[model samples]
Target: MTCFLIPTVFQAGSLSLIMGCTPNASHSPVFLLRGFSGASVSSSLLFLLFLAVYLMTVVGNMTLVLLISRDPRLHTPMYYLLRGLSVIDMGLSTVILPQLLAHLVSNSPAISASRCLAQFFFFYAFGVTDTLVVSVMAVDRYVAICDPLHYHSVMSRQVCARLLAMSWSVSVVHTMLHVGLLLPLNWAGDAEGNVNLPHFFCDHRPLLRASCSDIHSNELAIFMEGGFLMLGPCTLIVLSYVRIGATIARLPSAAGRRRAVSTCGSHLTMVGFFYGTIIWVYFQPPSQNSQDQDMVAAVMYTAITPLANPLVYSLRNKDVKRALRRLIGCGAVDS
Candidate 1:
């Protein structure tokens, strides 16, 4: 293996030399991304479709945030958490989609190592925020349904703010831990020397696959830490829902039960969609055939989910629909 030392500057104002194992090859500080190579669709069409979806995701999430903020009726704990979820969805899509759009248009789809690291950091942070926010929403729902009398006292404005703060803090720390583990590893390739990543985004698994470094410890840490980040919230959500189900079942009137179920229906749908895709992407065993599946799954959680969330909440939620109508009517009157 011929080693070439290439000096590069990270965003942190530090200069480091990266070692490449390819013989007589040009030393490029950029990492080439293999984005949706197996797609039968043309890149131009794909780009346009995704661009539309991204626009919709941003606009929809922003509208949801505004609706929650403007409407006094939605000033409850549930809507507060939903607004946070919208923020996270918007952030997650923004971080991933612009880079993806650039890659789709460019003939050479590559990113600098520093840029890749930054993307990875923001992507994971937003994703963890999404998960934690959803989990918090579940708990909020549980408190509202299971302990209705004390819900206000338990999830007060101050308490809700603190919970949101805690979720963001945990997300930042979780992303930092992953990025810290990834930073020290070398990206030298194998004997045949392929360094291009298979996925569009700078995900941990694909980056690890491209590296020639010993990732045993890294993998272990990912399994433990990543599992906690993924499963812990999911378990909480499931438990909360189960308790909610029991409470709903115990309700005296069928109308009351229906109301309770409807209250959580939108959130349940989102959690199912988000975690279902996420679980398939991360937990499934890696295989040659599964590459396309993984990419599709990643797209679902990153792009499709964000776009769908506002639609789900807005359509299923009568309060939100009424609030939207009132807001639009007020705007029209002003105009």
Candidate 2:
């Protein structure tokens, strides 16, 4: 992988002048991304493994999207939101995996500054989209389980559309702030004149850590805005599930309780899986051992979680299975 560096003395001098820090003289247009180092596994093998996972992630999420669209049975608000989630999953994986794979094969793996910013923008956009969509899905489950009679009225097609739009808008604005703030800053390299990004992808933390500029404001934005964006949706999701659990407990029939639990099981699993890794990665205090930990957590949320979402939903959901079978049957009949 490619990496870049700036001297601390140069950084200090540039910081003194601020706008006087010339990009052409101090910074290379390309930044080196140090991918997994000291790996027991070979790069070729790593490449193959990541490639297979990427393909599976794309195909699985795309299949989920198509299945939800074509199947009339899945035309409900829940599935509509699910289709949106599937699209986000596909986008998230596509944003990182292709460039990552390309870097893995290259003798000199590096990305231009412009490309890095674009990658950072889309990565966080989809990530925030995932959080909001999950929160919305939790709300959908709460209505369906706790307030069944009002479900159709509350979660109308128009409402679903609005919610989806709102999710995208929020994500766009949040990422815009992040990228907007990052654009003007000067990044200084380490003592060796290199900016070393420990993790695989272009994450916010590594970039922040590597910068020579005064990052107090940037750090503040990450803590304040980033915290709310992540924590708010998580709080809503938790509250919705808590209410769902109470409602399930009050059901008169055992079968009713079973049905309610079954309806929410897939979503709960996904929420746990996605949020658990994220919290572990971002919320924890950084340490000497944190680099490897961060890389592993990054892989989980970016690659593994997206791949597993479709599996969890499809395998647990009989409706999706039936739809898939019917689709295959129709295709076979046409042949």
Question: Each model's C-alpha lDDT?
Answer: 0.77, 0.77
Cα deviation of 290, candidate 1, in Å: 2.6
| Minimal lDDT window, size 10, model 2 | 1-10
What lDDT score is found at residue 196 in candidate 2? 59
What does the lDDT come to for candidate 2? 0.77
For candidate 2, list the clashing residue pairs, or say none. Answer: 2-32, 2-33, 2-109, 3-32, 4-195, 5-193, 5-194, 5-195, 6-189, 6-193
* Alpha-carbon RMSD, candidate 2: 6.0
Native-structure RMSD, model 1: 7.8
Clashes of each: 0, 10
Model 1, 1-335: lDDT tens digits are: 00000000011111122344344332224677886765789899999999999999999999999988878888999999889889989999999999999999888788877889999999888887887888899999999999989999999989989999998999899889878887876665434333588899887667766655555666666656666666778779989999999999999999999999998999898787776665555455534354565576678878998898999998888988988898898872111
Badly placed stretches (over 4 Å) of model 2 are 1-28, 189-194, 280-288, 332-335
Task: Estimate the TM-score of every prediction.
Answer: 0.87, 0.88
